[model samples]
Target: MFCRILRRPGVLLNQASARSLNRAIFTRSYPFLHGGPSIDKKTAQKITVNWLYHDGKTRPVSAYVGQTLLQVAHAHKIELEGACEGVCACSTCHTIFTDPVYDSLPYPSEDEEDMLDLAYGLEPTSRLGCQVTLTEEMDGVEVRIPQATRNFYVDGHVPQPH
Candidate 1:
């Protein structure tokens, strides 16, 4: 009886279906939850970035090529918080691209779209810092960090770590 049940083909199909359902449910319920991007330090180089603070202050720093904006900000002691640790998960790292640089970067991903939708001050050229990688073309990028972030669920409760 045990062998027969183990060999049942429907069991495998049911398990696969359940896994797919779980993924869809989780993605929909928590849009700002995701894994980090693959990092290759070999591609690391130096670049320049200008950060505009919420209080009308701007600062320039040397950032590493291929490093996400969130990483550079954190390393330079900027006032930005990557609540999701550069995983493109939380909108806590939401930033606005200013002028010429905004038109140079690639478009945002679907997951980024979902998180940006929940950001406090969504703009036409807003992007998650974790999703934007530094490139040669983006040498002099200008990013603006908002004063506060809306780090809560739709129910007005902060998300708890699992």
Candidate 2:
């Protein structure tokens, strides 16, 4: 059913109701289905993210309110991995925030902290990407992705999107 729909332009699975599609794609029902929160250009809140990569490359991307860091990275095709998806089961989505923004975000949850322990290059500002949701106050945030990620549990393989 999905394949047939994909073969057509501007179509979705017939079994997928409007509400279901909105929930699954636009909202957080399945985090993997969406890279970031739905943004309405007119009234949408915008946040600027400076992503520092392992290659010493920096990319700036826009983030919408309520979207997680992992969402923005994935949306922008940055190389951070969400090995456990985005439920914080693993630290493959580890990220670090620059000083001001680092101090700006709320303290990490126990689950996030636990996962960070498994992340590579853990630092004082280290955080699980999936756990850092954007807010109005975080308009000019800067996050850095570690040079390498350890996903030994996933056999060291980072799955790519289809």
Candidate 3:
């Protein structure tokens, strides 16, 4: 009987209905699928910045609004060496972010990608700190500095605090 029904023309599976049903069922059945809380820029204030050093130290600080990651790091005296001064011309400021934050960011521009190709310890989540403009959604995110950068500086370059 099952084989006979499948052979009938109108009895075939309806892809459109099946897809809609699955979407509704899965979305409602799984709460995590709804994604976390929605973030609004107006309500998101006092972002807590995290700079994880190569030595396994976390130097947390407050970030100013409308500042890039590199700027925040520099302002806080973090060791991120933006050799090109946030121009995306060098990979000295390569930083790693968590998966969700990394995913939320827009794709890198051509210049940033060209520079990132030269970064050391590059991972899928690796990005140039200078190119990452801080947003409300990035609050409380950890920025992992790799062991080294392709630049001439050593693995741990300590620059003077501004």
Whole-model lDDT values for every prediction = 0.71, 0.72, 0.71
Q: In lDDT terms, how accurate is model 3?
A: 0.71
Tens-place lDDT per residue, model 3, 103-156, is 999999766776677789889999998778777777888989899877745666
- When 1 and 3 are scored with TM-score, the better candidate is 1
TM-score of model 1 vs. true structure: 0.67
Model 1, 7-99: lDDT tens per residue? 477565343334333433444433234434444656667779999988899899988777788878877877666665655556888899875
Best by lDDT: 2
**Residue 114, candidate 2: C-alpha displacement in angstroms:** 0.7
Q: Which regions of candidate 3 deviate over 4 angstroms?
A: 1-44, 152-162
The TM-scores of all predictions, comma-separated, are 0.67, 0.69, 0.66
Ranking by lDDT: 2, 3, 1
